[model samples]
Target: MRVGSRRAPSAPFPGLLSSAQFAALAAEYRRACGFEICACDSDGKLRRGGAERPSEGRSVSDLRKHAVSEALRWGEPSVLSDGIEGVLWAIPVCQNQKLLGGLVVTVTRLRRPSKAGALDQRVVSACRVLLELGTRYNLVNAPLLSERRETARREQEKAEALHLMKEGTFDTIRSIYLREEPALIAAIRRGERSAARHAINRVLTAIYMLGQSRIELLKSLALELVVTMTRTAVQAGGNPENILGLNYQSLSRLADISDQEDLAGWLCRMLESLIDAIESNSRLPGSSQLARAVKYVEEHLAEALPREEVARAAGLSPSHFSHLMKARMGCTFTQLLTRMRLERARSLLVHTDAELAHVAAACGFTDQSYFTRVFRKTHRLTPSEFRRAKRPIRNASAPKSQTSARLYKPGAAVRC
Candidate 1:
């Protein structure tokens, strides 16, 4: 198939994908996957490739609009459902951190293939291929897609960091990062990519929160992270020559970035590349699976986590995961989980003035009584007693009684 022209009249920017090329790609997807694909411009206008195929109880236009909106907002491939029985996938086409257009794939319930898992994988693969093709065809610089995706990821993380900032003071956030940095480097050396990614979020959020949104400061801190990660990667058996070359290039790029969000994105991407280096040197079998399981536990510590749920997250059967956990960590899954939750509860007790009940709930304990019993068993002090012993002195002008009220729980006596 041949593209007629580089730009479309209705496109918001130059180098818009031509209608013939768009339709050709859509037609290819339809032929292979039995789904209809359409291209929509930045303004949510259906420039080319969309067919007027209606579903039961929903119009095609409504589904297309939802796909377009979701793609633009998230800048990702999102799978959504029409209220009826159809599935819609929105794959955003971006160039240099700009959302130029997107591809929408629609498949009705009745038309879905019997092998649903295979179908889903094919859909994801097709979205990736289409995105690469579309971006490469339109962009003069193919590497800009990474920047575009990073920009979107940075926006998401920025929103999350802002939300977290509202809940903690600058010191609280700064301390969290200080504690997490060692764990981040440790995870990298162990080639636990998933855990490193989780730690990266905590570290990145703290940087964004404490940097006060200063671009130059953010760049400097980002460079510092690069140095730390590169050093850790070398310790993990990554080639020093190759790693340092990448490090120098990252520093050059960091020097050029003027936007805080872009810097955040670049740091994340660079860290992941360092992680890739570390992972390449990993010697353990199923290390990725173990890393995933550890990451899943870390993320769901506040929830009612089960062995089966965690195993599924790690893509292993429960029995296999249990055996793996025992072989690798020298402990049962439940034992590890209990230790992690208790550790988190201990940190919360020292860092924040959250009540015992609130802390218990946040750490996934059944109740304050159970939490206190476990706390006393582990540390020989009740939760309130531990807090009073370990909590730092407050400098606020509020009266002691008023400050104490925040930790007061009605109907509960403080037991030492």
Candidate 2:
């Protein structure tokens, strides 16, 4: 763009491009060139442009370079008919020095340039100048070459950004999954339902974060992340049989992000790894013992206890429990605790006459106010309201209870 250039020009070039003008212009040019078929190739596809056709694609690319070199050097084309026979001549159809494809022309019949034909070469030379001005600088046409380069650059930028984001995000997910394996396993052993869910959810949240970014990441990378997350969830004491356990569908939702099969395969591998981890962690020493303790805490949800207290009762140190949790489940002990309390509170609020404060206490909240706050934050609602909405009225018919369906669905599910 120049100092006086506007984003768009006001007027149109009629004879140059409009059908009415183009027909007349073509006729005039034909008369000037002794009635020959004239063709144009703004994209360098010479064969596609001309009716008789010379060659196209890679062949056109080669011919174009030759044409540009010869025309710039010796000035003017050789022959128009047997275009291949000519000493190629092509001048750039440029606005400034930016090469916008090439301007090419040839005589209808293969006319050899004799020593006496210097005068006709001047006519061809003049035509090239007209083309340069009419097509490149006119108000009617798009800057095709500039547009092409711009579009290519934009696509390249998107791909590069997606690659970088995907790598960083998945690294975080893997770390979170591996770090809390032991705690998750221990919780599952102890039969602590909430504990297992906490680990599962952390992984699920990570997946959601990646999914939320969704700026068109490499589909393969996204798919792999989803698969890896799903497998990990299932491994960490999660039940794949329960959609709430593995949440494979949630992982699969990211498939549209990438078309690369390698990512998809990697996702598949990750899922398998999670399944393997879960099966093996369950057989560890004191797993059943831990499971009992976990179940006690789960059934008696009124105690808002920490992972360390829970681990101590199960005869394991918090560190050991944490390791077992992550190995068995794919998330941490603290995460499991938070999920359990929240889950219990959600149930009491929805299904019982327990007030918000009482519900919070039953779910392990020491203070009713704090329980309400956490409940609001987790469910995006006040405790009383969540209960009111979730509870089926005595007179109204409703679908199956959310508590039964959602609380124990397979795969991982998130509260927030």
Candidate 3:
């Protein structure tokens, strides 16, 4: 996450994907979908001698640039067209929302069939998913790359002295430590207290082996792990300034820790503190809290639930939870609850033979008339009409056009 002021590399991101890998992916696209992939910079300038180059016509060039710009702006794949030429797909190569560049592909002569357009979209979407996978791979593996570069020289010297001491001991321990590092950071990000603690123990066991009989070495290793944990904690919604200040205090205490057992306990305690910090920040509007609130509401939809009761389930005050619902969910608690109830009602109407009154009560509606009113207002169809339209037809010859009427309103801002 640290930004350096050194001269930037020629590629959009060094070590993220090599040119060979990029070309291979492009080739795969060509072989599979007859689409040519081109590499473009953040400015939408096609990379020279990288992948397949698109036509340098002004319109094609402008379309590609605009596609890249849109993808970067949204931090996702986007499609663009100049109307004359066929569709252009831009899959941005971004990390942490920082736009580096992107891959541009074009099907200049798309078929008039809707299936062709859908197939192209599907292929491009798959490519975007793969690139995102690569981005995450870099995020998880970058630290290992840097560690290897830093230890290569030390490892060479250790090899020269191997005959005079234990062989493969340091390598085995170091490998185990590196293997636990990704798991530890992942668990920390997810706020899994037990899993993080266990991974830290495994990492400490490896560090202890490497620093056997050397307390200073063990302390330094522990400090290194602390630094990694703090970075991860910050990424997991912990306050940066608070975490940094806490880390400073933890480092100051590390100097007095000379016993291996004491150091292990201290690190475990430190991990717990990081977990607490993450949980403390749960009051802030976030997907985890929103999902938890929605899940609680859904699980208790039949009950006469109040906002205060739901807020307690989400571990937030009613007022704060109201604010969170507005900020992250773009709806009030009542609106979300009503929407969820209607959704459940729709399901029960189509999937079960429940009476309208029973369905209304089961979905927390006070009465059947009220449920029908709200459902018709939101969906533009009465609950009975919706059931008739959506109910599976037993006749195999049923015309598809019979079910063409839209049953649910897609324009609603909130569904949960």
Candidate 4:
């Protein structure tokens, strides 16, 4: 009788040994090399061996954790010895610059293996051979695995970046970014070129150090600085067209920057240009009370914003502050507040997946119902509809129309 063809059991890592195969390999190594063996993944989770209870006064679990952590931290083979645990060796297993996991071996203290000893050399060679085989297997049958490893590495890099930003090295930089805005604006308005230049230099230096000379990260931070400069220019009475054009130009050229120093110099020049324009503008000097009111409104956008409270904060009577606000901003205090809150709401809606009720409360609306009514009246669509429309599918062939245009146009007023 003819027999049908049979398929072999597939290994999770393909040509690499399966768990049972690895167990048999580990047993062989233990017998040949006279050492206890265990394995762990890149995240320090145990994978094989070390199943027996710990010897008296020795915790097997803690030893395994330490082994994995050491291997990952050093990114190389490391050996640790203790009176009770003998000699513990941690060997990192990596492929294509990606850390896969580690192999740990416990050697007897009686042998006392040194770095150049025959036993140590043999064990290291064996571990390297196993990792090499695993690397070849991954390359041949698991290209997707390489992509996943790269994504993990990138996430780790971002986490490190955030940690560094919070550390002492970058803390002063963050303070300048957040707290020196008013000072920078005032310097620009007063045409204090040296003071403005000093402020800009401090901020750019901080960004440079924070980005660690990485071109992509530096460009990301430079673009954020551009946004801040644009807003400050607008508040300083610079022509909107000039300020926004500079912003657009800077952003468009970010990808072309290769050197951190060049990027910093370019940004400083652009900021200075914006400040010059602001100083040269024919508009009368902005009222200090109006500036104070704007600052107060920005800081208190989430709270109840009564006109009397806002006027008091600006050091003006309610009626006079209301008149000046209309003359300066071309809108009433309530209208301006609503516009600011809705601007914040629009930003959150586009960038986050927050619930509508949460968005309402965050933008200072008393309730979701009121937020919905105002949002619909102003934008001609509900919040949900607006969000859905904004998230367009990538690479889809859709023709643009007036609907998209209206969604992005300025002067889309919110009636208070």
Count of clashes, each model = 0, 47, 0, 0
Model 2 stretches astray by more than 4 angstroms: 1-290, 393-416
Tens-place lDDT per residue, model 4, 1-416, is 55897765443222444766666656766544446666665654566665634645655556655665664554434566544646566655555455566666654464444445446444455445444443443421134334554455555645554555566645544464665577677666655565566566557656766778588888788777777777888887898987777777767777788898779777878888897678567364347767777778777888778887787676555766788888877889978998888887886676667999999988887568778888998999999888888766412523344433544344343333
- RMSD of each predicted structure: 20.6, 29.1, 20.7, 25.5
lDDT of 3: 0.66
Number of clashing residue pairs, candidate 1: 0
Off by over 4 Å in 3: 1-178, 280-416
Model 2 agreement with the true structure over 1-416: per-residue lDDT tens digits: 46876553211222333434434544554543334322234444442124333442235455555654443333333332233444333444443444344445443333455566343443454455444434543521235534554455445545544454566744555564565567655554544544654554444445445656444554433444455455545555545665334455545655443433444444444444454445445544755545644665665557546666777676455666777777765667657666777876765565567666666666766567666666677789887777778766522533337545565444333321
Q: What is the lDDT of residue 102 in candidate 4?
A: 61
Worst 10 residues of 2 by lDDT: 8-17
Query: Where is model 3 poorest over a 10-residue stretch in terms of lDDT?
Result: 403-412
Better of 2 and 3 by TM-score: 3
Better of 1 and 4 by TM-score: 1
CA lDDT of every candidate: 0.67, 0.50, 0.66, 0.65
Q: Compose the digit string of candidate 3's lDDT tens values, residues 300-356.
A: 888777886787676555666788889887889999999889877886777668899
Off by over 4 Å in 1: 1-24, 39-58, 91-102, 110-122, 136-145, 161-175, 178-183, 190-201, 207-416
Q: Model 1, range 1-416, lDDT digits (tens) per residue?
A: 66786644443334656556665666666654556766666554566655666677667666666775665555455677766765777666666566665677755463356575445445555556555555556632345545556677767766765666676744543455556677676666655565677677766777766777688777776666667667767876777877877787887887789887788688778877886775566554676777777777767888768787787677555766788888877789878888878877876787678988999989888567778878898899998888888765444335556644544323222111
